[model samples]
Target: RSPSLNLSFLYFCQLMATRGRGRGRVGRGGRAGRGGRGGDQQPDPLNQQQPPIFQQPPPHQHPPVFQQPPPNQGQNHVQIMGQFRVLSPPTFTGADGPQAVDDWFMNLERIFEVLNYSDQEKIVCSRFQMIGDAGRWWSDVWRLKTTAERDAMTWEQMKLLISERYYPYHFREQMERQFYALQQGNLSVEEYEREFTRLSHFAPHMVDTDFKKSRRFLNGLQKDLRFVLSSHGYLTYAETILRAQQIAASQRLELDAAQQTVAQPRMIQPVSVQPPSFQPVQVQPAVYQQSSAQPSGSGGKRNFEGKKKKNQQNKKGGNGGRGDRQPAQQTPRARPP
Candidate 1:
């Protein structure tokens, strides 16, 4: 019993020592944590609790400070497919021109509606012209003119300007090759130029330049429609216009005929006829007629005849004598057809 009690006492002492060591370690750890978290101080390296520096935000992560732009910032060249191109026509001073040359073609497209060009020829041609001319006009400022100068330009000059300046770069490049080929005696400039000009006329962008001149050109070409048919392409826009116009005229004639048919007066028919009325004829009573014939009974013929003469006289006077000659009531009658 004595040895067992001694062993129990030894176990209690060991347990108390273990508890004291654990409390001392915990208190030291708490002091270290509080010291590392002190205000206005960084944590000690050994005691640092946050994620590593690499995991934290970089010093340059903040946005750049705001600054005033330079005076001409608005006119800066806009980037296009890695190339910076002028944003607007240098002549234009307002907000920079639309982002793409397609905007310029939009004006031509709008005009296409008014010109009644529904086929793809004008659309494709005008777009090519718009894209081509932007590059050309960008390189050459003199090509654009004041409104007055544009208005004063002759139709021939306008057509030449459009073909020379506004045609698509690829198409013009091909034309240049042919022009050089013609120069080398491989082809004739007149024939090739005529072909190129006729073909280029269908591009959508070409319509933006001198549309009135284009109409005139088409009209002139119509006189020599045989040449248009013989062209290498065998596709003439002049022919398209002629066809569209024929359709419009035919439609107009049809509409006019329809209007005439609508405007003609309509004939109305009578549904029924009214028959003539038959009225009853009132005849005098036999007794009244006999009395009138005799005229002799009121004690003597002279007295009765005197009364009859008086009644006759009253009726002739338009009085219809008061006591004995009331007017008869007549029935209503239908009108004759």
Candidate 2:
């Protein structure tokens, strides 16, 4: 009830308050709180100059913004759209010969277009790494090594270098000579014309006109077929070519027929049936001799009358002088005659 009792009560209350404060600062396992740990912990030598590790780094004046790259800047910061679909890169196998240039260049263009890298000269040069001749050609001839150098070079410069090594302009000259010099040879008309058309692509100026085309075709045609084609007065290359093909086909058919005949063994031809020969009739000359021996009617009558008269004369003379004169007269008359 006195001042002393009030002092005791106040002391107990302060102790109870102290205990509650301790419980608040300490964790459930009785581990020291963050403030206590700080007091107990040693100072880190590494963080002596810097702020505590727990302290957050100051916020940027603007937000922690990544600096966006400008348009057509480095590829690293570029955000490519998914809509730009890319196709597979084209490959060259080197089987197409010098004409490989067409495929290689065209394929490279297609790849570039698909990849949206039409302006990337470096990308184009880099693609040559896929070529079969890269080691031999792109390395040795051009003396190019680094990617930066290749990327810097223009495509034309690279193309000329390639052409110089593998296929030169002189190849075109050779093709020119070959085109004019091409004769039909043993090739069929259609085959020869096809070759002519393909070769003409190499030398378009040579046969640019239809007349030139026809002339070139006629010139290359076989000697046997040319004259016949020319006589037809063919005006266009198409007409000449068509006629030549027809002629060649006919000639080929004839040749096949002749070949077939020659290849077969020769057989003896059958003899034709003939009519029987007629026999000659025999005639005798004796028939005409017998007919002449037969006397005419008038001649026979005269002979009869003469015989009758001779008989009468003999009868009359017989009576008179027959006896004596008959023998002597017959003998003397015969001697006188």
Candidate 3:
């Protein structure tokens, strides 16, 4: 046999022996593969006559897609009523009661919340940013910034010093004030509840028990919701809040429907026909009657009688001449307007 024929024959036999295992492993690694390995594998030669062309990958059968999540808008995100205000922080005033202290502290916290601040220390340091009366107050609180004073300055220390100086009964006074005034003004149930929760934090003793807390909250609700929530018979604060929220939602729907009804123009209702027994009042049109030689009213009757009597008297006087004229006709003369 020829050398080339012998070589070709040897290659064919080697391919048959190794084909099964090599086919399974070729063109893919476990997990980290393209389309993946399969039984229908094509053979690749160890050596090629020419360099191979790299074919482009096929387009996706199903493309990877992305969907955006919907915005979660609760009561916090109310409609833009007026322009957003960057409110000034309140500074510590001198020798005020717990009420003043509470107001100042709450104001400080509010400004921080509005500015999306998290650091308490940063919030405390920001007191220096106050102006006018507040500026004076801040100066009093933070005098000459010596190295020793700066080292001692902390959020807790500031709070402690301020509380001790301004508010002796900070706990008791705050609890009393908050408990006394927690009315639900113009806010919705969700909005009111958020405020209620915030204020309730100041008065832990008043709201120590869920039962007492629920009662207190119930008392503060507006008349309409208070009446509705009362009837539902929920015990715990959580349950009462849930039930009130449901009522509020339903009330909102009703209000929306009512507003829609009011906004749109309505068809005028037809007036009912009057009964024959209750006839329409007949309005007499004024008549401008021509006045006769002798009119028909009482004055006309008197004038006619007077003329007849005079003629009779003249007849009695017998055939008098034209010169013998009885005084001119006694007709009523109209007064000049």
Best by the lDDT measure: 3
Better structure of 1 and 2 per lDDT: 2
- For each candidate, what is the lDDT? 0.45, 0.67, 0.67
What's the lDDT for residue 266 in model 2? 75
* Reference-based lDDT, residue 326, model 2: 46
Clashes of each: 12, 0, 0
Better candidate number, 1 or 3, judged by TM-score:
3
- Model 1 scores a TM of 0.17
Best first by TM-score, ranked: 2, 3, 1
The alpha-carbon deviation from the true structure for residue 276 of candidate 1, after best TM-score superposition, in angstroms, is 17
Evaluation by TM-score, superior candidate among 2 and 3: 2
lDDT for model 2: 0.67
RMSD of each: 35.4, 21.4, 27.0
Which pairs, if any, clash in model 3?
none
**Model 2: residues >4 Å from true position, as ranges?**
1-90, 93-99, 102-130, 135-158, 259-337
On a 0 to 1 TM-score scale, where does candidate 3 land against the true structure? Answer: 0.34
